[model samples]
Target: MLELACISKTFNPGTVNEKKALSGVALRLEKGDFVTIVGSNGAGKSTLFNAIAGAFYVDEGAIRLAGEDITFKPEYKRSREIGRLFQDPMRGTAPHMTIEENLALAYLRTAKNQNAFFSRTSKAEKQFFRDRLALLDMGLEDRMKQPVGLLSGGQRQALTLLMATLVPPKLLLLDEHTAALDPSTAEKVLGLTREIVAEHHITTMMVTHNMKNALELGNRTLMMDSGRVVLDIGGEERKGLTVEDLLKRFKAGAGRELDNDRILPSE
Candidate 1:
């Protein structure tokens, strides 16, 4: 569903504080592929995501999604085809807006309707939002009029997840969507993520710090380092792999052990 060819990106080029964030990184994902990425800090995990999300143009690369070239597409334009969620629960939402309002904006924006910005939600659309929110099992359907700011961290994150997939974009990028919450809440959000993705068969890429969750949650796992993808494992090979096995593989591929000592076995 997505393809990247020779993707390379650098920051502050030709300066004292220069850093290459991505180096000839190439990857491909088929439809409904759930890809989980784990890497130590400065490994270009987020940069790869930003590159795909059109946060910045890659120095040299071509990005194609569902057979369309979006290499130079503006971030706003890509939003129609790509759905993204960040570590911070507050990032994707308008804190002062009611839950229903937030859902409406996301719905209209991706609906690709020319009248999206000016259109008002009909009673039927409001009902649709309520039904979708109800699927979160968070009591948000009844609280549609409540400001998003009133929700707890997990609740808002769940709401954000709902908004992102309300229309099932061609691709979904999750940048540690649950990393900011407590373990229990994080687990709940992760469960919601699994269900939503499966329901729509959304092709997804999730960047996570927990090695255990990385291995357990997705169909494929990618290990990245020094701005390049060092390892990609999936299917039968991935089913037999454990966290320690993954670590050893990373060491072999990256020529160095992963640097993050605080990486735990579980979320």
Candidate 2:
């Protein structure tokens, strides 16, 4: 459902501090493919995700979603086809809005009538929101009237996930969505991620620093280094691999062991 071809991005180009964030990065995803990406700092993992999300224009290459070339499309223009969850728990939702209000905004994405206010929830819409929230089983339905600011980190991220998938975009970009949560909560959120992705059959790319998570979730695993994809493994091969095996591959591909402290396996 998504394809990136020979994408490259450079910051402060032609200057002494010129840093290439992405170098000829190419990737393709089928309709329901879930991909987990891992890399050390400055490996271009997040850069690639941001590029696909249209956060900024790439210096070279093309981005296509479901056969539409969106390389030159503005960020807002691509929002209809993409859903993103950032690393920060606070980044995805409006704190002052009630839980239901936030969901109302997301539901608006698929609305045929532009004049309608998502917050003006009809009985039918309310029921729909309630049914969706029930899937989280987080008692969010009861707290629909509560402001999102009052929610815990995990709750906010879970709500963000719900928002991202509400419309079933052509591609979902998860940039360390569970990074800021506590261990137990992160686990719960990860489980929710798997459930939601499977149910919706949405194409997804998840960037994570945790090796175990990179290996455990998603249909494919990609390792990046120095602004390029150094390794890609998936399906039965990835399923049979261990953390140590991934480390070995990283070392072989990058000619050095991954040294990022955050890339270590979670105990």
Candidate 3:
């Protein structure tokens, strides 16, 4: 459903701080593929997602979603084809908006009729929102009138997840989505992630620093270093592997051990 062909990106070019973020990086995902990505700082994990999401255009190469080129599309134009949840829970939702209002916005995002008016709370919309929110089992339905700013970090993240997947875009990009939550909350969010992805059969690419999560969540796991992907493991081979085995493979493939600081312990 998504393809990145020979993509390359560089930051601060022609300056002292010049750094290459992607170097001829290429990736392809079939419909319903769930790929987990892990890499240390400066490994271009976020850069790759940004490139695909059109946060910024890549220095060179083409990106296609569902067989259409979107390399030069602006971020907002690409929103219809992609769903993203950022590292910060606070970044995804509007602080001043009520829970129901936030969901209304997402619903409007996928609305086909351009002439329809947007509402903060329609009975039909509220019913749909309540059903979706109930999946989190977090009593969000009871707080639809509350400002999103009042929610806890985990609650906000859960709400963000629902908002992102409400319409089932062509691709889902999760960039360190649970990194800011507490261990228990992170685990809960991760489980929610798996459940939603599986239920919808969405094509997802998740960037994570947690080794165990990378190894456990997706159908395939990729390890990146510097500006390129160095390791790809999947299928029966990756099914029973542990964190230590993944680290060893990363070191052998990248010619360097996995950075200790980036390998989050199992929570």
lDDT of each prediction vs. the true structure? 0.92, 0.90, 0.90
TM-score, predicted candidate 3 vs. hidden true structure: 0.96
- Model 1, position 203, has a per-residue lDDT of 98
Ranking, lDDT, top scorer first: 1, 2, 3
Better of 1 and 3 by TM-score: 1
What are the per-residue Cα lDDT tens digits for candidate 1 across 86-114? 99998999999999899989888776557
Clash pairs of candidate 3?
A: none
- Stretches > 4 Å off in candidate 1: none
Report the poorest 10 consecutive residues by lDDT, candidate 2: 110-119
Better of 1 and 3 by lDDT: 1
Provide the TM-score for each candidate, comma-separated.
Answer: 0.98, 0.96, 0.96
Model 1 TM-score on a 0 to 1 scale:
0.98
lDDT of 3 at 10: 92
Predicted candidate 2 versus true structure: per-residue lDDT over 103-141, tens digit per residue: 989878767687888757799988888999999989999
| Candidate 3, residue 113: how far the Cα is off, in Å | 3.7
| Candidate 3: stretches off by over 4 Å | none
| Candidate 2: segments with Cα more than 4 A from true spot | none
